[model samples]
Target chain A: MVGIVVVSHSERAAEGISEIAAEMAGDTRIEPVGGDGQGGIGTVPDAIEAAIDAAAGGDEGGDAGDLDPVVVLVDLGSAVMNADVAVELSDAEATIADAPVLEGAVNAAVAATDPSATVESVREQAEAARDVDKL
Target chain B: MTEDGAAAVAAVAAVAERIEAERDHLTELDSAIGDADHGGNMARGWAAAAEAARDLDDPDTGTVAKTVGKTLMSEVGGASGPLFGGSLVFAAAELDGGVDAETAVAFAETYLEKVEDRGDARVGDQTMVDALTPAVHTFKKSIETDDLPPIEALAKAVDAAERGVAFTVPIRARKGRASYLGWRSVGHQDPGATSTLFILEELLAVAADRLGVDAPETDATSPTIPDEDPDEGASEDD
Candidate 1:
C-alpha cells in the first residue's frame, strides 16, 4: 500500500483535504501530513521536515514491509521548500509534484487509492489532468 | 475563538506563516521562467492576509478566506495573483461561514472550477489544476464511502494529493508562462504543481497532528537541489 501525504501551510486545510479524500476512497489506505509554518506558511526546510514527520508518523498500521513510497503534494512556494526538506530529512523515497489546491486534491485522492498505482503513475495522472481538453 | 471559528483562524495563520517562510524559494522558481517576483508577491499578499487575520480577533472561515483573497488580489502581482486570489474568493463563498471537513472539500471544488474557468485549461496542462482536480475528486469519493472520522478522511485526501503532485512530471504546458516553452516544459516539473503539493502536504500534517495519529515513517532519500538555471522554460507570454 503506497502512502500519500498532503502538505500545506495550514493544518486545517491539510486536514480538510485529507478528510475529503478518505471519505471518497472506501478501503484505500492513505495518510496525510501537515506542517504548520506556525509563524508563517511558506516553504521552509524546517516546516517541510515537520510535515514529513507528521505524514510518516500518521501511518495507520505501521506496516513497514508493505510501505509504499510516499508521494507529497504542495500548495505554494515555501510549502514546497519545506516539503523538500521533509523528504530529505526523513530519508524517504518519495516523489513531489506541484498541484492546485482543490482539483489536484480530488484527482490525487482517487489515484492514491488505486491498488496498482505507483508514484510515477500518479504523477502522470496529475499531469494529464492539467490539460482541460483531456478532462 | 468560537468553537468553529478557532479552526479558521488557525488555518489562516498557518497559511500566512508558511507563505512567509517559503517566499524566497517561490521567487527562485519564478525567477527561472518568470519575472523573479513570485516569492515577493506571495509574501506581500500573505503578509497582508496574516495582518488582516490577526486584526480580526476571532473570525469565521469565510471571513478569513475573504481577507486572504482580498489581500492576494490587492498586494500580489503577476498571473498567480489573480489565480490564487480568485481561488480564495471562490472558496470563501463556498465555505460561507463553516470550517468543517466537508466545507473544506466543497471550497476546494469551487476553487478548482474557478481556476479552470479563468485559465480555460484542463488537466494535463501542467498547471496547478493538475494537482487540485484529483485531490478534490478523491475527497468527495472518500466521503461517499463510510463515516470515517475526519482525520481518517483527511488521510485519504492527502494520499490523493500526493498522487496528483507526482503526475506532473511528463506533462507538456498548454497554458500559463510555461506554455510558450511547449515541449520544453515536459521534462521539468511545474512550479504551480510544486506549490500545490506543498499546500496539501501542510494540510495533511496539520490534520494528522490534530487527529493524534502516529505519523508514517519512510526510508527514502532527499531530492537534489539544482543551481538556478536560465529561463529556457519561460512561457512565450512571459
Candidate 2:
C-alpha cells in the first residue's frame, strides 16, 4: 500500500493531520513529523526524512529495500522546503503533493486504500483537492 | 587543510560573527513582515556551522561549504534552513577541486539557482533572489567579460548586492512569509536580501584579508539586478 506523510510547522499539527487522515487510511501507513527539534514551531529536514522512512516501512537511515512508495503533504513556507530537502535526502520513493496539507492528506489516505494506488495516482488524487470548493 | 578550504572556513566564521552582531537588526527587519526568528535562527545556525567547519578533519573548500550548508539545514529554522543552507549544500559540489575565480563564479551561480529552485521566487519577488541575482551576475561579468582580478570581482559583487538589498525596499513581496502581508510588505527591507549582502560583504572582507591586499573600491549605482527570473520560473503564488 502507498504511504502518507504529513508535515507541518507544529508537532501537534502534523500529528493531528495524520490522525484525521488515518480515519481513511485502512492498511496504509501514515506518519507525522514537525517542529524545530526544540519545542518551538518550525520544520526540520531530518525529522521529515525520518517520517518518510517510517511511512515507507523502513527504519531511519536503513536500507530502503523494504519500503513502500510514500507521498508527503505539507503546509506552507518552510514545511514545503524542508519536505523537499527530506525527499532529496531519503532513499524512499517519495514525492511531495502540491496541495493543501490537510485536505490532500485525507484525499491521499482514502486513495491509498486501493490496491492499484501508486505514488503518482495518490499524488494526483491529493492534488485534485486543490479545486475542491466548499461554500 | 587546503588553502581554499581554510579561507572558505574563515569566511564562514566571519559571517557567523557578523550575523551574531546583526542579530537584533535582522530580527527587527523580520518582525515587520515575517516571523521574528530570522535573526536568532541565522545567528545560531551560522555559529554552529562555523564551529562544525572548524572541527572538520582535513577539510577542503567543498567540504567546508557542504558542512556549513548541512549545519544550516538542520539548525536554521523556517524557510531559511533550505533557502540558505540546503542551497549551499547543493552548490558546494562546484567547489570540489577547490576555489578559484572560475569556480567561485560557478559556486555563486549554482547557489543562486538552487535558492531560486527551492523558493520558487524570482528577482522581483522581493526575496534573496533580488540580492543574489545581481551579485552573482556582477561577479561573473567582472571575472569573465571585464577580466578583472578575483578580489576586484568579489568587491564588485558585494557592491552589487548592497544595491540589490536597497532595491528590496519599496517593492511588494511576491514570495516567502512576507508575501502574506500583501501591499504592506512594501517599504520594509527584506531580511533575507539584507543577510545576503552582509554575507557577501564578509566574503569580500575575508578574501581581501587573506590575499594580503586592501579591499578594492566598487561602485553601486541604481539597481542593476534584473526585473525577472532569467528562466521565468516564478510561479504565481501571489
Candidate 1: tens digits of C-alpha lDDT, residues A1-135: 445577665666776887886776555444454443343433334444444444444444555344456667767554554454346446446667666654565566677678787878765555555554533
Candidate 2 lDDT (Cα, whole model)? Answer: 0.91
Against the true structure, whose lDDT is highest?
A: 2
lDDT of each: 0.62, 0.91
Worst 10 residues of 1 chain B by lDDT: B218-227
Runs of candidate 1 with Cα error greater than 4 angstroms are: A1-135, B211-238
Model 1 DockQ vs. reference: 0.02
Docking outcome class, model 1: incorrect
lDDT of each residue in B155-187, candidate 1, tens digit only = 555555566666776777788777777777676
Q: Per-residue CA lDDT of candidate 2, range A1-135, in tens?
A: 789999998999999999999998998999999888899888999889989988998853456677898999999888999999999999899999999999999999999999999999999999999999999
**Model 2: how far residue A74 lies from native, Å:** 0.5
- In model 1, chain B matches the true chain B with a TM-score of 0.81
Error of 1 at B16 (Å): 2.5
Model 2 scores a TM of 0.93
Q: What's the residue-level lDDT of B161 in candidate 2?
A: 88
